[model samples]
Target: MSASELVFPPGATRRDWMADGILAVSLSLVVIAVPFVWLGGTQEPDPRVVGVSLAMLLPLTLRRHAPLLMLALVSVAGALHLVLLDVPSPSLIAVPIVAYSVARWVPGHASRSVLVIGTFASLLGPMRWFENTTSGNPSVDVLSWGACLGAVLTPYAIGRRAREVAESRGAEVRIAEERYRLLLAEREQQGRLAEASARAVIARELHDIVAHSLSVMIVQAEGGRAAAARNPDVAAEALDTIAETGREALHEMRRIVGVLRAGPEAGERPTYAPTPTLEDIPELVARTSDRARLVVHGEPGNVPPALALTIYRVVQEALTNFLKHAGASAHATVSLSYGPQHITIDVQDDGEGVEDPTDGGGNGLRGMYERVASMGGSLRAGPRTSSPRFRVLAPLPAPPPSPPPTHRRS
Candidate 1:
């Protein structure tokens, strides 16, 4: 909502008029009875004094609605009463009431004007009251002046304090609302970031599964077709490899699709095949081609599941790149080294291929790099100066130590 909508339209409500009306009527009746009380109703009171008193008291109806107008009316009548009458009346109570109303409802400049008018009245009203009786007693006049000044200033101070407190509360409410809006914005940004992360994972998974599987399948189909006339067994074996590769690709695709479709509210859990790990690297290399060989430098230890997945993807992507970029007769070697602090992988192919295998603007090498880097690992791929035309070297952090087993007390 805008600021204008939060503000009320100008003018008093029915409730304000009704409440102020009652107060004005009640005070007027008391003001009317004051002259009779002064004389004890034993004699007729002066008509002019009663008339001026009513003028001062009657404008209380506009005290909150039109405080400045009410103050003007009361102040004029008060001046008249001071000039014409010798005694004070109950109608004078309206002075403090008007002072408070002006301070509470009027703007700063206009409200401060009331204090000037009030202070003068405070001094003059007392002097007027004691002009005939005091016989020039300084102490008594000063005390009366102070008393009258207190009446006007006390209510004015209270009104100003009330306004300040209300403004402070309004400021607090605005701050709390602003903070709530910021919190909502922060949550929305986090949701968008999570969605982007999920999409990246999907893209990377699809690339790995489809790219590697299709490359192997294509090579097998070509070799199988070429050997169909000469060697029936070789052709048959190649067909089997293609079928197995296709089925594996389809299964991995179904896993990704099922996860995308399932929601927490659906109460459905799709059973997915276990992810490939470091132990599965040999089978992966064998399936790729007989041209690629695997070599290990150190003993394997307990590897974390995530690190295992990273290693498998890295090898898969490297072999895929080798097949895609290297010549037909090129031989490749995949070497793994396990150490106390890190695990290293090297996939090298002695093929006449592009100088920079990572230079092709394909997502295959990029996905491998991302997968490795996500596990606090580093990957490098390019043509080497030695026998290998292309080489991909990666060193990944070792898994943390497992907690010791606890024996049963019994």
Candidate 2:
């Protein structure tokens, strides 16, 4: 290792170097007093004491990293200091400090063993020191052992308590981080679900709009082609109707496209015309070239926009299904009625009762269901039980009734 590397490790801060300096200074005092220092009367010093104390204090810098080993070495050094020294040496104090670190780091069973050894050593060393200085006195030995045991226990207990508190704080931090991660994942899943739902709604709207408009144009085109052989004027009118239908579809396609383009892009907001409603039912019937009849009952009152669109889509899908599946000879009846608390729409057709390609689990039918459900409505679609006609009846919720008028007293 380089000289600088030996002095301080990589990323070692000023505070770390300061702490090492402090520990070094404190342990130097213990090292100086242990072996080389002379007692009050003795002129000569013991070389063995100096060697053992230096071994103990030099390892104090590495005590935190290798606490158990450091404590063991310091304990041996303290024992040797008691055995070889003639005069009392205070440098053996490094043992109790290392015992605290061992208790703070080592496993419970091993640390308990170390603590017991430390207490025994603390008791025996002082008593042995007394036996050498004065005569072996029972009361003096007891006092010395008790005082030394109490000193060793104090630091160990404090270190162990601090370790438990630190461990508890670390566990709480981990639990909180786990909970936050779970919450973040849940929010991400919710965003995906919401995006999927929005896409589904847009798909349904586009499917209903394009499918119904195209079905009518197809029927009219077939009629125009056949009728041209008999009456050119009638065929010409059908072509005109097709052109009008195409234009309407184009305009609506632009509106829906604009709606789809809504995002961070500048000036892309949709400019929707008034949406189709029950009032537009007559125009829808007329455009079918007398293929369907419109029958209205009760007062046609204004309804909510969503409910009106639901009624319109139901009629459109039913008529499209009739044209595509029931052959050109089929005729449909479109009916609407305003009730006290609801508005009902019924579309029925008398045609060849062939199965529809887009009938079972089809997007058109699914779209129809979505529309009705959005307006708090219910729809039943199938061939009539007794008749040959296919029918779809949708009943939608409406505004509540106004309070009835009270009779006036003249």
Candidate 3:
């Protein structure tokens, strides 16, 4: 379907065959001319000489196109010329070249077999010629035959090995390219998933900030309107509270926007306002308490702002849930314990717990779980053993060392 899928039949190009034909024809002409020009006319040129040369040169044109047939034709012509009349010629050069072409270009097992057989046959031609010669020099004959065989087989062996090496290297390159492509694809997928997670987190923070603030504003406005006709001072205080709450909400929104704008280039330095911590717990309780009382225990210690913020939010959300679901007579107890390695916060209400409080498919509890997990801590929220309870426990990361103290004595 694609260009990569298209397959080409293996063989030499037309250019290759044409080049070999030209070389073979030129060499034959030179070899045939040597006897006439250089040998001083001692032996007359045979009429079959032209015919034998043509026969040898013609078959080479198709050496790559039809290698087996071409090798057979050249070998038969050379052998015939040798047996009938001894002729000194270079026509035998075509035999080995054709053999090498067949081995290098032909794709199938059958072609390779043909190439091997033809190579052997080509080698035998010189051996036969040397053996039948009247010359008694055995060493010369052996060396000449060996040289001929070596010339014929060497190119074939070298070409075959080159093709094998090229094929192996090509395969390795393809595998490496494929692996790189897959790794890039995986990284892109992970990046998309991370972006989606970040957007979801931002959405939850926006919802909590807007929903909680708007609810409080509505309640304060109604209270002020009702009290205005009866007590001007009380209505003025309610108005002031409303304004303060609105400003706090705006500040938080601005902080959220700033955080969202901070990109990767913002570096590892902390940005936005310091997150709300346990010190802000009294304010959180007072906001939703109405007629309820707030009590806290434990010596204050430095805690990671991220974990502290999580604690504050958990308590806030728990109180909000209690306000909405619990009766008006319901009251809550907020407790905090700072340990050597862990900080624990509990928001317990003396009212009817949910039919199934554990069923927290909403993003509120899920967000809390994610925040706690990010700090390498855990959270559990359900009914207390004795009374209704919503508990959150988080392990605080070790504090960074304080700067050296400076003191001046009188």
Candidate 4:
């Protein structure tokens, strides 16, 4: 039998073997001694008879270890006893016990063969008397044969069915464990991906908020220096603008940092200042007006923080690009339109747009594209009818329903 078919139950220790040996020996002794006591000691038992009876039980001790060999040994001993004594003895009963043991422990074809052979040996043992005697009780012989067969086959059949049930349960447990392992692995992968995506988003927001604010600060600083020598009023105004823009930028930075530092168990709270939306575009455009024309159109309202921040960053990045690449006097237009289902923002400049920004080691357009795409939006930046255009279109998610108002009787 293959190792797969054999299942050794847990806690089958040396003590268990000792216990089984004691039980088998006791049962055999009972089978051998009961008949002699019943016959009232009138018939003197032969030494060979006692020796054969004892020998028959030797196989029972090793039944579990070597079932097939033990059954064969017991059968041979029973047949030899029948031929020598010419009478069935209590030792012959051991044949069915050994046969059942073999059938219960052995696997596949070996177990079936043992059961069949054991049944034949049991029934035929008493039948040998019919061939020898002129007056033999057929009813007693049949009953004895039936009882022997039942004793052997019943336990073997129960053990075989139990083994099959145990094997099936083991297989189900293994399959469940495998599925659990796969699910755990998949969850870990998703967590890593989510972490990576959060970091990328934080980086983009920091770049837009800090970079754009710093650019305005630099320009204002330069203007303040140039005007400090001529007009004190102009320099003071420029310095005031710098201070306000710096404070706003710092506030936004704190929010992003707080979100990054917070743990997973942190409750929902305001992590940062509310994100800038379309309404803030007028102020954003006013800051960089010296070199670019900023245009705003559409009735603006409050939007989700994430979408609002996206709009603010898109415009900020577009203006930064114009200032860096286009000449100081280059013309640019910033347009924002809010519709029922989506919001569109377009930044166009008459300056020369590079066919490939990567060749120049510039990531402005690439960053802009990534930012838009992450929000389930689209961004297109290339040459238009006569100038270069960068446009963003983002679908607005449905607004959550308002909670019902509480009422009291007047």
Candidate 5:
């Protein structure tokens, strides 16, 4: 079937259809010229006889459409042409035309069966014609039989070759299409993972933003309330500080909100500025009440954006914990030791230790642990051996060197 399929149709090639057309035309031409060649002794050719020879070849054009059916019909006509004609007839060419179609379009087992039957005819067909006509030489009989076999096999070999080539090309196309589909699926999976990671980062930011800001505001409110009944100036200053802190928190909240509003599919990437870093820790301590102090021993060099944000979170969360659990008279120290290869943070509060665990514990410690683990760091929080103070010790590794950039030729 592959041999006879149209090249433009399905997976067939144009060359196959063209070859079929050429074979059909060649058979038709031989059928038309047979009458002139055979009318040697007769005065003129009979119109009805020539018409019958041409009529048998009408099925050749549709040979590829239904090869076996066309072969059966044309074969019956060929038998009649050989039996009736005293001279060589055009209808005789139909035998080879139908044989070629059967070999090309029929399945292999069926084609071989047809070929075996045709071989028998190749031997007997010439004897049938030679017996009714002249008493010919024995070698000429052999030659006619050889011609029949050669015609049948030439096109069969060509058809088999065409089928093999088509199947090979079709397999290659299928493999390429399968590879493309797998690559597209892999890209889609990567995109989904990236989106999930971005959302997780955003969730962490939301928690830290709201939690830290609210904790500071609560302490300021409590201080303002205690002084409200006494000195009016001190209470007013606390109110002004609270207002300023609230406004600053609101601005940071807007940045987080803008990112959420843009959505994941936004064309222009949303940008937010002035992210908290190591340098901002000084400003952070200045904003808090004077009972807590931050001390740095070494120069904290430049760091990655993510690590800087992590450092800011560690300080913020530790301060929030001190405010919540420590007594009013307690003092806390936030010490940072920036070494050549590593950085360490020590937050110690000399206040009443964490209360009994009857109250529901918060998720702040768990969040802080996860944050430290993500940056390949370690954190320890517990009471010191000699003192009744709570201490948090964290050690972070230094970031790797940046890769050098390439310079294009001028």
Candidate 6:
């Protein structure tokens, strides 16, 4: 709860003011009636005494609003009552109430003043009133002093304990709210990370599919145009290749869109074809052009699906870059070698290096590097140091060894 709620709770502001006003007025009336009641209505009370007593009692209205100021006003009036009044007036009741108010509402070292003042008043107030009384009990003065101290100290102690408990509860509430806020922020950050990862995956897939397909289509269209005037059959074959490439690109795009629309929790199974793997690399190279060739150096073993996809994408992106940067007559060699601890790929083109460095600074190389690195592999792409040819070399970490088979005895 807020500070205002502690002072005047919701829907209780007017009620609190009315109650405090009533309390102050009632206490003032009692202080006024005490002197008359003590004299049994036979003698008149001093006006100055009534005024000082009301001064002590009236500050109770400001107790919750301005506790320090109320205590100060009450203390000054109380001093005056002690010095000027010979009889013990009921207005002295405001002492304990003021002590409680100062203890509860005032915080820090300022509130400690209440204990000191109460202790002093508890000793002095009774002595000021009963100094001339010779009670039969010789310990009457000490007993009066004890009774007065108990009245003030008891309420003050209770108020201090109540304040401590309230503060502890408030601290716990604030800590819980802070923890909840941190949890929400953490969840939001994780969501953003997941979204960025998904986008990167989608972008890499689209680059491999669209860039390779467009490059092949562009090469075939040019070939078909040149051959159309010389030989109609060759031109027809080129046209068929271009059409097939476009249809495959469209199919892959539809598959991606279908996955996105279906969402992860979709009940129905996906109808799209399986992803490409190592077995598909030769067909991919053949589709690129007759100038491109693929050679395998070692026995191909079982490869993980994700690793297979990465290898296929590397080849696709390399050939796509080759078609764009290499001359129209340039020949390309794609070497795939399987080692005991690595799967290596080397794609090279025998043509002058990229004319513009800016053309080589696109997302193609970075995407390839990121894909390889995420699989605990490395990628290197640049012009060959020995010749004016572009080269892409990547070596991926080998998959973990399969567990040995175990035989069970019957």
Across 87-151, the per-residue lDDT of candidate 4 in tens digits comes to 76677667656655655577676677767776776677657744566356777777777876776
Question: In model 5, what is the error at residue 263, expressed in angstroms?
Answer: 10
Which residue pairs of candidate 3 clash?
none
lDDT of 5 by residue, 149-188 (tens): 8777777777667766767887999999999999999999
Please state the error at residue 129 of candidate 3 in Å.
4.8
lDDT of 5: 0.73
Q: Rate the local accuracy (lDDT) of all candidates.
A: 0.85, 0.74, 0.67, 0.70, 0.73, 0.86
Candidate ranking under lDDT, highest first, comes to 6, 1, 2, 5, 4, 3
Judged by lDDT against the true structure, how good is candidate 2?
A: 0.74
Instruction: Please list the residue runs of candidate 6 whose C-alpha ends up more than 4 Å from where it truly belongs after superposition.
Output: 1-58, 83-85, 89-91, 135-143, 262-272, 354-360
Cα lDDT tens digits for candidate 1, 1-410: 33332222145788998998888888887778766787889877678777887888888888777787888888899899888877787788888888888777775566877788889998888778788889788998988999988888999998888868867998999999999999999999999999999999899888888888988998789889999999999999999999999999999999999888888987998767788888889989999998999999887789989889888888898898887888778889999999989999999998897444333366888888889999998999888976549899999998866789999998
Better of 1 and 4 by TM-score: 1
Reference-based lDDT, residue 92, model 6:
83
Error (Å) of candidate 2 at residue 395 is: 2.5
lDDT of 4: 0.70
TM-score of 4: 0.71
Q: What's the CA error at residue 188 for candidate 2, in Å? A: 0.8
Query: What's model 3's overall lDDT?
Result: 0.67
Which pairs of residues collide in model 6?
none
Among all candidates shown, the one with the greatest lDDT? 6
Model 2 misplaced stretches (Cα beyond 4 Å): 1-26, 29-49, 86-93, 106-113, 132-143, 265-273, 299-302, 355-361, 386-388, 401-410
Candidate 6: what lDDT? 0.86
Model 6 agreement with the true structure over 167-205: per-residue lDDT tens digits:
899999999999999999999999999999999999888
TM-score of 1: 0.82
